[model samples]
Target: MMVDEPPASARFVVIGGGVHGLSAAWHLAKELTASGENPNVIVLEKSQIGAGASGISGGIVRNFYRSEAMTEVIAESVAIFEDDREGFGFHQVGYLAVVPEVQREDLEAIAEHQCEVGYESELASGDSNCREYLEWLWPDVNSEGVQAVLHEKRSGWADAIGTIRNLARHAREAGVRIFEGVEVIGLGYSGAEVSEVITSGGAIGCEAVIAAPGLWAPAWWQMQGLDPLVTIGEGDSAEQRPLTEYWLAREGDYLLPGVGLAGNAGRAAPVVHFDHTAPLYSDRDGELITDQPWGIYFRMGMTGGSVVGGGLPLEMGPDFELDPYGPENPKQLAGDDLSEFFTSGLAFALKRFRGASDLWDSNPNGGVLALTPDRYPVADWTAPNVYSILDAGHGFKMLAVGREAAREILGSAKSSLLAPFRLSRFGSGATHVVSKSPYPWT
Candidate 1:
């Protein structure tokens, strides 16, 4: 429900109405209800729910990160998504990553760690085996320079908007009052802690504040009088970098009217991700697109057709506007060059995608990602009473963040899963291990 005005005060004030914010509110309310305490939680949304990045996310849920810490967090999130497949709009068709020999070692190591954590996945190595594995799912596979394949049987995608709506419903049902069009301007501090959330509607006194502002996080960080820049490394190698950098990802779908993942029989196919070093050639013209390494991911769209996307992201300045986000912003749309690159890359990977250039539909999805220094996420308490969920573009999939965050906010000990992504990691040089893949968030 969209409340016209927020209460004069709330016990717990959550900023932002995207996946992170709503998830936090829902989980917090659940915890409060379980403890027989009043769930005086209020969610303030500048726009409406799912109006930001969460609305247009690819919704790809996978635990294929090179970082063990991220993998663990994602694994836990996958379990949550699995528990409520219908409510979360999860497909559970699974996720497949096809990579070249250059990433074989890292892929194997990640697979090993995933196994150690009891996450189910399969690894197929060597060009022949990899091709065979891909053929099992996609018979038209034409991957070149591919040497290994990692398939996560439990990972898949969800409906981005639907998930957020469901989350809002759950939160409201748990006694969390959500007020849309209620923009939070700033936070009022009492000594070192945030005493109230100053909003356009009115000031709402609160005991604690959870900031999950998504793309507007940089602005929130500044409003709180915190530095937006930080040191990325330690000692001699340490270098200062902006804590938030924006990148516009090119994403779209192919309108193959009557086709889906043909090789997978009638069952839905897993999300297919390709990271190859092979030269990409246009299926329509045989002209070489690029000989350099590239990455792309695609899967069956919910309504129909194939959703395909992937290319080098276009970097934006720190002061980029956040008002018109996603495809709604013309500047965020995939250009001709990127559209051609992504479509051609898709054609290069699958025979079914041949001539998909003309069928490209770029309006469905595309958005700017607010990335951290290491392109991961930061979920920690920035102040004594302010908990920030800065996901750096990995929000929708990591639903477990809210559950764990709710526990911590209620005075539980620091979460081991979230400790790895603390803001202090930047100064301590405890950043995640960079991957060999071209994609920043591998």
Candidate 2:
């Protein structure tokens, strides 16, 4: 459970201690134990668990996606969260995506695709229908200029820290060795294979390594001398590939009126998303219009009288870097200026938040995600014995990522499910194209 001293070696060394790392470790340990093998797994954390995006995430869980792969993985993850046995801090309230008139067709297509994939998503279109659904759920919401809404009956949000801790506890209970405050500085490569993990605490010899370093993945990949670009494959087959460049996208968040809004909307209120521009106003601030394309999401706050939401913008700027242990990390040292910007931005999207007294808390600390050319996760063997997991800031997919990674690693079953995300796909032209959704990652 707890490691007082770093073991000299391990069968598998997992880097980072956030959601993906803990989930991967727990799943790996569980599988190893079940198969009657000594699960010599070690998790090395530069800091405490949930010290990254997973800890500060808005914790939205939705099975809505344009890609079938994403939809399946998310559905699987939701099942894990709903297991009750895992003790994840999840609330299966539901998720709603509201789109503008211009995006109504896109929303319809996505909704139809979700249903085709067996997700319980409904389409409520037209001004009357959309407004009716909004009023039926949250009466205070402004639904003007809306074309349609995609409501996923099973999606919702969870407590970010609570879910991370729960996953870590499960990993510990399963006999995975977790070392806090231990950092993996470098990987000792034997030819194409990583023979050892050099850490701040000590060197750990391992047969294989899975690096889910969250925002630190870029730095780790650079340290290991692996190209940041992933090769996409031609056609649907990931077997043949061509080299391509990739980048990471930055995701940020801000809170809304939580408990108070929930009380007004009803208990366990559904998660809400907005993709249309609207006239927004506040008693303190003047009229503002929602930005085009980029949308925002909101759900009830863990505590009373507040809601939580954030900006979901596509990547367009220079790559983001982080100093996890220093003030250089935006998540660690959020300035008043950034906080004000997030609040003001959210206000432009939601009219109900105009006169609410100082109810916004932009966790100002944000993180970056590895985005493939298509903005999907890159999960596969990047090198000999080295598996890279690029989550693209998809927090809810933690459980599924760990489960699938362990399944494929143990060789008990070959998961064709993960083939689409393989590194070789980039060069093979087996890349996913951007969806019609306003959000690029979709």
Q: Model-by-model lDDT, in order? A: 0.84, 0.70
Per-residue lDDT tens digits for candidate 2, residues 1-442, read: 7459889999999888888888889999999999899988989988888877677666888865666777777877888888853377778888988888877876777787777767788899999999888777666667778779888987888777789888988899999988888988888888888999999977899999988887676677787886665544545554422122222232344455342445243556688777755543333455343434546566766666455655534342335445453335544444454444345544544556665437655554444444446667767876768777776656544478877887777777766667777766567566665555656556
Q: Candidate 1: TM-score?
A: 0.96
Q: After superposition, how far is residue 438 of candidate 2 from its true place, in Å?
A: 4.3
Candidate 1 clash pair list: none
Stretches > 4 Å off in candidate 1: 1-3, 355-364
Candidate 2: worst-modelled 10 consecutive residues by lDDT: 240-249
TM agreement with the true structure for every prediction: 0.96, 0.84
Give candidate 2's TM-score.
0.84
